[model samples]
Target: MAKNTGGNSLKLKKFLNRDNTVGYVFALPFIIGFLGFTIVPMIVSLYFSFTNYNMISAPQWVGLKNYVRMFTEDNRFVNSVGVTLKYVFISVPLKLIFALIVAFLLTRKSKAVSVYRSVYYIPSLIGGSVAVSLVWKQLFSTKGLINNILHSLGMARISWFGDEHAAVWPLILMAIWQFGSSMIIFAAGLTQIPASYYEAARIDGAGIVKQFFFITLPSLSPVILFNLVMQMITGFMSFTQTYVISNGTGDPNDATNFFALYIYNQAFKYFDMGYASAMAWILLILISLITFIIFKTSSTWVFYENE
Candidate 1:
């Protein structure tokens, strides 16, 4: 019996060794790529965040001075924070709501539904590009398409890039137009809902609005939460639209000065790599906090059939 036990132990050790070898072999490429690309840069950035590095000389240790200045003396930082928060809170919900509405319409039976979906989804595919952003800028420029339409219709032309309040709207509107990603997610969620729920609601004399409120919304709450989180993250990280529309300056009193652009300016434009790294870390923490809050509150409304 002791001999048998010793043999089994040896066999188990060999099996584990063979399995470990196979696993490591399969994972080697990803591990090497991560170490070379992600981990090394992240470590260097973390180190840089604590030091003053202007990309011209050796890094000087600054401790938390950058963070301190960011909170206490940086008015642009504060304004960018406020602008980003406002942009996220406003654009995310509106975009998701619009996506949901469009998803509802698309859920209706129609042979043209496929074509409509493709058409609506195309904007999202190319919306984040420099060319599309330039197009949007042109559309919202003072003498551009929108104002041209207003002038043609005997209305006053609004200054999109000159007014602090109105400059951000063009960016927000452009963001909302790229609702195809959320809309597609919503459409998938809508499709997953059992049709019998709506049918039974109708049998009980429920109106369209009632059926939607009672059956559709509750069933799709999980998907709504998903889309909300995703869109909110995207809104907070948004750069191209505001950058292109405002000519990379977030002009007109800096109403559209997003945090990302601010970080870019600090790093490349101002040569404050350390400050940029600190801001990048801060943004990451802020996003993580918001996502945490969303997830913490999700249990209140997100429904799961398996639960």
Candidate 2:
């Protein structure tokens, strides 16, 4: 009996050893890379958020001074937050709605469906680029393409970038034009919805609107939630288009000033690395909280067919 127990223990030890070796082999690269690149930087940044670390000088511990200053003293930070919220609220829903409409159109059987999808998606690929923003800046200039076209039609040229109120509309338009990513996601979700449901609805004398509201929407709720969350995050973090369009100043009157751009200016332009780190942490918290709220509320509205 003692020999039999000893043999079983030996076998168990060998099996455990083999499993450990294989697990380590598979995880080694990820562990090394994460520690080297992500974990270390995250730790460093957290420490820096409590200090005064300009690039040229050693960090001086400042406690919560940076955070307090941001909340109390920085009007720019407040304005940027407001601007970011506005952009996120306006752009995300519009983009998602437009994408859904386009995706629905694309799902129809048509000879030019592929071409239309390609054309719609092209804007998304190009829109976020600095080069594209530069082109947009020119095109929306008082003497640019849009104004020129209006002039050709004997209409007065309107100020697009000159006025602060009007300047933001161009950026909003640019964001709306890049609905392709959301459209692609919606298209995939639409494809996953069974055609049998639509056929049954049609047999029951349901119209197109009825089929969409009852059959299509409930089925695609998960993808809609996904796109909504992603678009909100992306719109909130938007910087490049604003930076390129405003030439990094967030002009005219800082109307294009976004939260990420504000952080960038704080860190690099003003050499307020510690303050910028604090702002980054704040942004991280904001995004996490918003995402959490969305997920928490999702159970009420987001339909999971498999469940």
Candidate 3:
């Protein structure tokens, strides 16, 4: 019995060693790249967050000065935070809702379904690009396509980029136009939902609206949660559209000065590396905390079909 047990242990050890070897081989590129790029930079940035590391000079330890200054001295940081929060709160839900609606529409059997989906998704592909933002800037300009159409319709032209209040709307519109990713996710989720459930609800004399609220929404809760979390995170981290559309200044009284844009300004524009690193870490913490809260709250609403 002892000899058999020893033989079994040896076999298990060999199997485990082979598995480890295969895992390492599969993970080699990622491990090497992570250590070389991501891990090293993270470590360096962690250290830099505590030090004044202007590009011209060696880093000097500043303890918590950067963080303290950010909280107390920097009004811009506070304003950026407020702007980011507003953008996130406004854009995320609109994006998710629009995506869900489009996805639902796409799920219907129509000849033009794929074409509509493709058209909706095209904006998302282009919306984040500098070229697209430039085009959006042009389109929202006083004499541009949108205003020209409004003018052609006998309406007064609105200042899209000039007015602080109106300037943010263009960004919001741009975000809403890029609902493709979320739409795709919603489409996938819609497909996973069993048609039998809907059929049963219909047999029970449930209308489309009733079936949607009771059957569709409940079934799509997990996807809704996923899209919500992702949209929130993406909204918070938005930069390129604002940067390109606002001409990299976050102009018109800093209305478009998102948190990430503010961090870029701090790190690159102003050479406040330490403060920028602190802000990056703060944003990281904020995202992590928000995600954790979502996960915690998900237990009540997120219906896992497997369980």
Best by TM-score: 1
Q: What lDDT tens digits, residue by residue, belong to model 3 across residues 1-307?
A: 9999999999888876897887997899999999999999999898899999888899999999988988899888888888888888888889988898788768975668878888889998877888998899999998999999999999999998898888888898888888998998898899988889989998999997787789878899999998899889988899999988887888889888999999999899989898899899889988899899989999998888988
What lDDT does each candidate get? 0.89, 0.89, 0.89
Off by over 4 Å in 2: 1-17, 109-111, 149-156
How many angstroms is residue 144 displaced in model 1 relative to the true structure, after the best TM-score fit?
1.4
Question: What are the per-residue Cα lDDT tens digits for candidate 2 across 1-307?
Answer: 9999999999887876897877987899999999999999989999999999998889999999989998999998988888888888888889988998888868976669877988899999988888999999999998999999999999999888677777777888899999998898898899988899999999999998898889878898999999999988888789899999888888888788889999999999999999999999999999999999999999988999978
Give the lowest summed-lDDT range of ten residues in model 2: 160-169
- lDDT score of residue 68 within candidate 2: 98
| TM-score, structure 2 vs. true | 0.89
lDDT of 1 by residue, 1-307 (tens): 9999999999888876897887997899999999999999989988999999998999999999989989999999999999999888888889888888888888976779978987999989999999999888889888999999999999999998898988888888888899998998989899889999989999999998898788888899999988888888888889888877777887889898999989988998889999999999899899999999999999998888798
Taking all chains together, each candidate's TM-score versus the true structure is 0.91, 0.89, 0.90
Runs with alpha carbons beyond 4 Å of true place in candidate 3:
1-17, 152-155
All-Cα superposition RMSD per candidate: 4.0, 4.0, 4.5
Residue-level error in angstroms, candidate 3, position 205? 1.9
Instruction: Show where candidate 1 strays beyond 4 Å.
Output: 1-18, 152-154
Candidate 1, residue 125: Cα displacement in angstroms equals 1.3
lDDT of 2: 0.89
lDDT: the better of candidates 1 and 3: 1
Candidate 1: the clashing residue pairs are none
